[model samples]
Target: MTAALASENLASADAAIHLGNVSKVFGKEGADGSYRAVDRLNLDVARGQMLAILGKTGCGKSTIFNMIAGLTEPTSGTVRVSGKNPFSDFDAFRGKMAIVFQSDRLLPWRTAIQNVQLGLEMLDAPPADRKDTARQWLIKLGLGGHEDDFPHALSGGMRQRVSIARAFATNADILLCDEPFSALDESTAGKLRAEFVRLVKENGKTAVFITHSISEALEIGDRIVVLKRPAMIAYDVSFNTDTSAEERTLIRGRIGEVLAA
Candidate 1:
């Protein structure tokens, strides 16, 4: 790999995503109109770190991811990838990141490998190189045999896997996942979660995941950040050390308390 690839790998191992004093407001200001989706949110996601944002519905978790993906602009503050603002120059910012939304958003007519190649297509990567890169990721995600299968032919879990492979195929340093595994069955979801963690670790990609399941968050997050009603960061907990069985139970209890408060 070249020096740039080496730096991408190294950065992915440390801190790849950062949100500083960020705030977002929707609608007009007046007695009749106004809503603050995010409020002065300050968070630092180290490269290679897997951070999960847990909150009740409508707590602005998705909004935060949107800002990071440059899909929506922050009303105030900033979102940075490698110290550059994602909002100021979205194209450049996006070159360093990829987002997997709640929906798979796969092209129905395309085969699994083709869908994975779509990212490279948008970036205008050479045809032969894109094909090789796409196949590599599809195989990495256990979709090697299904490379020629279309979205409709695969199961839900398999489809989601394709989505993930596509995201990683971009080789982006940061991965923004918004409830990507929320729609699957418990067993399937759990399996995918484990696989996701493994992929992040292997690729050294920094990730920010949003989920409503407390168990899911605890299971995969290196750190969990909770958002309370009206959208504010209520608590931030790190789970860097190996978690014991008892510790896992305790963490779940703590998350319950935060949600209940």
Candidate 2:
């Protein structure tokens, strides 16, 4: 590798995402008035780490996701993914990141496998190779037999699975999810959550997701950050992989207390 390329690779390996004293606001502050969505917030998702941001409704959870995904810019401070400004350098993340949303945003015109292949099409992959990759990912996500089905023909949970399949098919180094399973029934959501966590861990993928469900965050997050109004971190914790039932119960109680406060 050239010296510059090697240096860039090293930087990408350092931290998957970082938000340094970031804040965002909308509208005019004095005349039209404005609201601060996030207030001098700072956060980090380390390389290969899965961090969950848990908060109540209207607490700027989606606002934060927007900043991280580079759909919006910070009003002050900085948002960096792999050491690059995600908004200004948006093209830098084309192949390195993918996002899965709560609702399955499948194109109705495309079949399940075709939907998964869309990202590859943007990357200029040959049709046959894209087909193979999409099929493998669908199989991995337990949608093997449904590849030819249209979105309307599948259940809600099945469509969500296809969404996840599309995100994973690109083999992106980073994944950003916004309450991806929130629309499913309890049982279906539980199963998909387990599958999501498994694939992420097994692939050593770095991920950031936001959720309102405390239990879901506890189940999937290696690190959890609780945010309140204006999006300040109220509780930050790291969980051990081997945590006992009793300890989890205690942790749950503590998180509840903070959320209620």
Candidate 3:
């Protein structure tokens, strides 16, 4: 038992996320009408790694995230995060994992600093501590002077920055982003994307990023996983800062071919 435990722990260190032969079926099959959102999917994401999950619309990408986020259960197989069942241990992950959705999702009434402090509040941090943390994050995200501004008074990009700051302020063990920058204009998105990559790498937090754009995945991911219809892995490839421009173009072309298939 000691040997098995050691092995499992070691594996967890190597991969913060593990899903084995996971399948999610909604309803019964045949006449009952079943929908197989994900089928026999397998994925392993290493610790401190940023993984980009790329898929087109209706490819069941969100289903996979729902399972990981402990929002839903898979009909068959298993899903684990840092070696623990995310679903069975949903409460255990409260402040340990943070998610950023496509939209800013900021509270209209809360000031930027107030919004950033919300997560720390939920995590039960003390008043002074939370305030300091929120202020630091807002400054880090380039909103120091605007901390007192309400979401309604901020621009789209600034509101999104607050949302990102809110997530970072939690200092979570893992970050899950679902098309977070897609709503922004290309210039704003590109700028934020660069900052995001730097922050994630510097913090060494494990992350799973979901996006429909192949280029975005390539830009941000240490590893890219492409999913086909029914959420099956079509491409799993490693990328690095050292990857040349020609290589990047080739990789993009390959991903285009895979998605087009």
Give the better candidate number (2 or 3) by lDDT: 2
Assess candidate 2 and give its TM-score to the true structure: 0.93
Candidate 2 residues 1-261, lDDT tens each? Answer: 999878655654577798878999987654557899899997877888889999989899999999999999999988899888999999888878999998999999999999999999988889999999999999998888999999999999999999999999888999999999999999999999999999999999999988999999998898899999999999998887798889888888988998999
lDDT of 2: 0.91
Worst 10 residues of 2 by lDDT: 7-16
- lDDT of each residue in 14-61, candidate 1, tens digit only: 446767678888986443678888888878788778999999999998
Clashes of each: 6, 0, 0
Show pairs that collide, candidate 1. Answer: 12-48, 14-46, 14-47, 15-46, 15-47, 16-47
The full ranking of all candidates by lDDT, starting with the best, is: 2, 3, 1
Which should have the higher lDDT, number 1 or number 2? Answer: 2
Candidate 3 contains a number of clashing pairs equal to 0
| TM agreement with the true structure for every prediction | 0.90, 0.93, 0.94
Tell me the deviation in Å of residue 160 in model 2: 0.2
Candidate 3 residue-wise lDDT, 71-146, digit = tens: 8999998899877888999988989889998999998888899999999989999999999999999999989899
Candidate 3 deviant stretches above 4 angstroms: 1-13, 29-31
lDDT of 3 at 112: 91
